[model samples]
Target: MNKDNENLVKSYRLLTVWLLSLFILAGIFSVLLIRLDLNLSSKVTTLFWLCFVSFYFISLLLMIYKTERVYYINYITHKEAQQATKEERRAFAYKHLIVFCIATFIFVIYSIVSLIFQYPAAVDFAVFIVIIIVSALRTVPFKLKE
Candidate 1:
């Protein structure tokens, strides 16, 4: 395989590992949070959400600026994108879709578990919706300027 194909393969492997690690860590964190039984006051809940939103957006911006260039082919400009084969594009899209599905599954399970444990689950639901919207936007087909 050529350099580009090798890079794409590496990116897929990295993304898979990173996402799996995230899922495990999230599961552990959620279990600990539930077990702690920390009843957060309204003020603390609001502050938690505020901080979550702020950090989430900041991290997203950083990922778009830094990680996408390294791991995502769709981040290229139209001219550069034109050089990529259709198969490459399709493969990348499929990989992204798989990632989205896995993430959605993880979050959905987390939300259900939170509800079952009688923990505050509104944040989990909100995060699930945000993930869906973000994945939808990211997976929208890109048009090349003719």
Candidate 2:
């Protein structure tokens, strides 16, 4: 196969690995949270939420990194990318960054609101937001770069 093809395969593999790793991490966290709810005292539930929030952010960061990698890979594989104007690349970057920021802000806001209301669903929602923001942001950047 050609270099571009090789790169494409590598990119796909990398994306797959990142996705699988994320799935495993989420699964482990879910199991642990369930166990915590069942075995621990009620007070520990708050701790679980906190843990969830932290994990959420960590996942987000990882996703962003992955997105950047994917975009970089695309740029490398696309020969015409060199011919593209610099402003075009910057525009793409800006758009993706804005999307990432908006998504992140939404989830962060939700988490804050939930914390204030002391709502049970807040924890899960916050965690969900984090995961979504992470995935969306990551994918958007990579795709935009193309």
Question: Tens digits of per-residue lDDT for model 2 on 51-123?
Answer: 4554554454455343433244334444443333444444554555455555656655665666676667655
- Score candidate 2 by lDDT: 0.51
Q: Candidate 2: misplaced stretches above 4 Å?
A: 1-10, 38-94, 118-146
Per-residue lDDT, model 1, residue 21, is 63
- Give the Cα-based TM-score of candidate 2 against the true structure: 0.45
| Colliding pairs, model 1 | none
Q: List the lowest-lDDT window of 10 residues for candidate 2.
A: 1-10
TM values, all candidates: 0.36, 0.45
- Candidate 1's displacement at residue 117, Å, is 24
Whole-model alpha-carbon lDDT for candidate 1: 0.50
Off by over 4 Å in 1: 1-11, 40-131, 134-146
